[model samples]
Target: MSRVRTLEEIPLRKFHWQMFFYTGGGAFIDGYIIGIIAVALAVLQPQFDMSLTLVGMIAMATYVGMFFGGIIGGYLTDIIGRKTMFLLDLGLFVLASIPQFFVTDPAQLIIWRFILGFAVGADNPISATYMAEFAPSKQRGVLLGGLIALWYVGYGASYLVGYWLLALGDDSWRWMLTSSAIPAIILLFARLKMPESPLWLASKGKVKEANAIIQKIFGKGVILSESFEYKEKTSFMDIFKNGYGKWTLFIALFWTLQVAPAFAIATYIPQVLGEFGFADGNMEYLGSAIMSLFYLVGLLPAIYLVDKIGRRPVLIWPFLVSSVVLVVLGITSSWQMSFALTITLFVIYGIFNTSMNIHQWIYPNELFPTKIRGTAVGFGTGVSRIGASLSTFLFPLILSKYGLEVTMYCCAALFFVGFLISFMMAPETRNMTLAETSTLNKPSIKFSSKPSPKRETV
Candidate 1:
């Protein structure tokens, strides 16, 4: 058997691409559903006669559901299995989306949006964990980064769908919201055919099943004996007990920093545009389309650079540049200057934000041991959603009370804070095996009970 200790030794093969498509498709659906809501709000506002604050509340409600869903999904993924959680999330998305087409009241729309958000949140932690586990160590960055890029494609598609539906008239909003269900349904069938995670199976004491799946993907006669080991059944506290407490805290903070400014900027894009003399009607829609296009364009380079440049540099540099852009955007009040600054900041935001997005999903899975990977990822992501939920309310209020320039400056400052936190907390996991990556930050734990036989030393 080969004794490979570093990520550089893992060979690339066809199986990784197969896993990428399945996981990426799941992320794509998430982006589609979430993006559709943003566009739908634009279409629905005139019909409902709602204020911007109320609209922001509708978006916030979704994140509130997502916050709970992420926690539940993470724990369930570890206990039940990756494939099962993945398939179930798709099912929830389909159920929630169908009723949205028929909703007449703002309350009904908010309720359905929250339900859909819960499903999207559940899918995120599971998909990120499953994709990282299946990928070879050397290619984890690219494979995972590509999955993020696919999500932008999903986001862009929503904008295009909204544009076409708007051209068709008011009835089109129903079509745009309900149309998201089709992709969820397609992903449901595709997920059913995909294999369970071999690593997850092995962690669960189902060694024989794990080996069978691994061999199927890696081909017959591939040795698995070295990889198989008895593992203790893990609980939520295992995250803190097994040298992971500090890392977990850091990751949670990292996610909060990312989510705060990102949601703040995104939730108020149309309002910000309108403040600068852009009309509140189709002009807002056109501006959003432009921003979405810029976001999609930014994702391409992130896919190419994530593995080559390392996670820390890619994630950090963008926030620093974005901080500058946000400040500049805040200072400019003229319509022409605002347009130039908005486009520039968003393009920068898209590039940097997409880079950070790649790491947020990929890093937590790699940072924790296989025993507690899902739990850590779920909790970290859940915390981030809470930050996003708060930003939904906070940004608009900040803009209302303090005005646009102060709000933009606050967002810029938040990016700097995120940069500092990440610099101190996040370790570089580039080109490292999951096992090696987990060891980068050691934790101090006090075990209440004696170690079980299943808890083998690394």
Candidate 2:
């Protein structure tokens, strides 16, 4: 007789890779949509004769929409199911994206951008949860890490596309804004054939249905993980109970610290590079595109290190190094160093800063249980955007008023604070099953396939 394997123990298979591609596809759209706006804002400012405040409003609009989307979409994913929200958001992505090409005013553009941001926000939690629930424990880090990796790839592609589109005359920003729909449509159709998360099904006490999916997708030999047998009603409030609140706080803060500076900087990278004398009409966009490449390159090492050295170290060290790099970059800018030297410093900062991208998708899903995983991830996503939105809105204004040195110094301080927090709060989830990581305080717990009414302590 053959040994039976749990879903968490299954070896690498084609279907697993397919899932990775499909889920990570949403991440690509998220990155492209977010990054392309940086380029669009440059054109929009000159075209519309917009004030600085209005420019900031247009830049920060998506993040504002994300704030609400993260909270609502996450709760809905937990209540309704992952696959439902997963598809719905992509549909929204397609519908909301097309209108940008036709917008005659900032208000129209902001409304559509907000809807697009909402879709990205909703997809963030759902995609992470779906990937986590199915991935084998040994490959989980790399798999989740790949999702973030794809995000950078998409981010980089946006700049490349934006740079290329600059040649299409003054109306190129319209095309750049509308370009995201292509991938969103592709991913939407690709995901249609994918099934619901079996772990989610098992959590809802649909064992037969869950098993059928497992057998169909992963072969008849694989079984659902025993932990999912403990069916419990998931409530948004559950994220705050059973010692999970600390994790909720930590994940939210860490994500915020990472993205606030990163997003703000990336959103205005062209302008920032211009400050250092790279200000030629399209030269800054080209520089921004190259810097985006370093962001993708940075993720390559982290994909391996995340599983090898443990999540805690991977989370903690990058914050320290990136903080120092930003400070150096600030001083270099103050000294009016050669453009090459400044660019080298910016590249270094970009690489080290990107190490945290992996954790953005990894930590939220790993830290919470199936019952409220979406809600927890969504809460983190929503909260993080608040900081990202504010910083992105303020970045250009600050850069104009305080100069590049102060902006870099302020960002460095934020990075240093992140280092301290992660050093204190980051957990090591290496080689641990979802069951182990979710209930960090109760490592010895197990579950039977039999139904239960009591709430699981995750």
Candidate 3:
């Protein structure tokens, strides 16, 4: 009896872009909400008489919400289905942002951001798995990389928007925080038409429905080989016992370390630049926008290289280079370089840090089966947010007390640990079908000597 063709065997088409833009919409909003806060905090903290610690807490709040949202959403997507979480999460995000425009105090802003963060957190795995499952294996890296690249674009966009919105005067922070709702609103309508992932359908044994979707995608009737079969049930423990648990762990741990430095530094870009004479609300937002632009630029080359060089090499080398960049940026900044030179140095730093970060963002969903992809990705992402939150919470105080040089050096050292993890431990799965990489085709630990001779699949 013939089954449906596996999702990877299907050709790419306009439907994929629909999925790309639909899912990317939420990601764009998440990045915007996360990015605009740097300037928003700069605007609001002094207006409200917030201490440095309160500033950190306010900054840390959204990440804290995202941490749990990822963990919960990850599990729910697997149990419920991808489409449900896709719409519901973005709705929650929109609902959370509505109150931000009305907030009068620090605690109110923090609470709203946390709720918004949870909704943003929930979108991560749902979008990652949705795109990975639907993408053709050969171009999977570019597609997933594209999904992540737009996030940086969103980050850059937020700063750009915040810069102009400063015309709202002190109230720009209100507009900046609330503006994330716009994209989330658009995604809800666009995403409603999206079908369940064919892989997710097949996982539930809805073979006819799964085949129907693939037919729409491939524009012809297709057969599902036995390779498409996936048990309806999944467990968190399964990720650990299966070879995939290691991929889960690497994705989580590396993301945690990578994020510790990225978000912590990005949060205070305005403050950091102020030392170089880029003060005032408008100029601060402009400098912050420029800082974010390099991250977006860094993602450009990855669109070409991630599929060509393979994930491990692309992931490893950029991380190593970014680590060096961080250390040198630290050393240079300590000496008080010319203002023009200082901004240029940080711009270079943004390129490498963002390139490596995009690679890290795409890893987890690509390495697991649909049955557990959401959970595994969520588990890793949730843990990483905690690390990110801690850094956000602590970075302000650390920088204030110890100076910029110490913080920069410490961030560089953390990224070096990320390099070690990617270089020494991360597996090469580029160009392989998810089943082949996840080893669902053969039930054995991949790290064991002589992993059951490689088995190719549709």
Candidate 4:
């Protein structure tokens, strides 16, 4: 049999594109789903007589489903295999999304949305882990960053189509929601023929099988490393037992702090613009689509610099910029702000917030090893969803009671706090291999034997 191999040692090849495209498709689905809400809520609020509370809940429903879905998917992907959950989650997305078009009531739509969220939750961990594990070590950050960048592309696509459909009159929301299913369908067929993760196979002691797969990736004559050893099963507690616990803490604090504000802004961009008097015609949708482009553009520098510079600097500096500009934007909100001024600040904030947020996608995959990578990613991503769900649910309430300035101020606060955490705690993960990261020391953490809460860690 050919010698066994480590994932990092493999040569980067054209084959990586298949994995990237497949996973990127899933990321696109996530973006399209989140972005569709901009138009869906606008149409629904008038059509269904949607109260702010109901509107919040309808949006919250998907996050709620995703929270559990990410957690459950972690276990399933880790225990079963990457390819199974990889393909399966896309199928669930298709099934759940299709029902959205036919819903006559909020309750029905909520159920379908929840189901769709669950699929999104599952897809996040599985896709992120797959990309990290298979990528050449030097290119890992770039590969992972690009995977998330596709989310912005997907978000942009939703706006282009949503605005066009919105002009179609009453059935606009249905087409907007249903159109997301097309990408998921395309992803499903693409992923069906993809290979299993070799790192995961090695973790299961399938050395011979892993090598055979690597041959296809690195060409037939290559010899491989045999250093990896496998355990038959994973202990959920192990992820928390060592320094891994601190990494888990970072993911929770870092991801939630970013997502709560980022998503809230994205979800309500059209409405926020409406409040600023861009209310009539497709200008709001058109403006929303234009702004989405900045987020995608923001990802370009991050894709180039995330590995080149370092994760902490890229992550922290952007948050500082995002937070400071947010304060300026908030103060200007009451200064009789001109539309040009407001859009300018939002453009700057959008770029920084999106670029900084790429770290969340890159870190979870880098922090854990093959054995627990899925579970860890799923759990950490799930925790972040709690913050996302809460912020989305509470956004309207906060916006209504406190108005735009306070809402922007609160968003600024979250980013500022995240900046401190990242500056103090974000490890230099940019150029490190997954194995190197898994063994890196923590900055200083308080640990206890009190098996952490189920929701807190794996």
lDDT of 4: 0.82
Better by lDDT, candidate 4 or 3: 4
Off by over 4 Å in 4: 1-6, 221-226, 442-458
Where does the lowest 10-residue lDDT sum fall in candidate 3? 446-455
lDDT of 4 by residue, 271-334 (tens): 8877766777766777898889777778899888987887888899998999999888778776
**Over the stretch 29-125, how does candidate 3's per-residue lDDT look in tens digits?**
8788899899789889879999999999999998999899889888888888899999889889889887898998999998998898888788888
Report the C-alpha lDDT of model 2 over 80-150, residue by residue, as the tens digit. Answer: 89899888999999999999999998889988988988998999988899999889887889999999988
lDDT (Cα atoms) of all candidates against the true structure: 0.76, 0.87, 0.79, 0.82
RMSD of each: 5.0, 4.2, 3.5, 6.4
Query: What TM-score do all the candidates reach, one by one?
Result: 0.91, 0.95, 0.93, 0.93
What residue pairs clash in candidate 3, if any at all?
3-223, 3-224, 4-223, 4-224, 5-223, 5-224
**Ten-residue region with minimum lDDT total, candidate 1:** 446-455
lDDT of 1: 0.76
What lDDT score goes with residue 418 in model 3? 87
Segments in model 3 whose C-alpha atoms lie over 4 Å from true places: 1-5, 440-458
Error of 4 at 41 (Å): 0.6
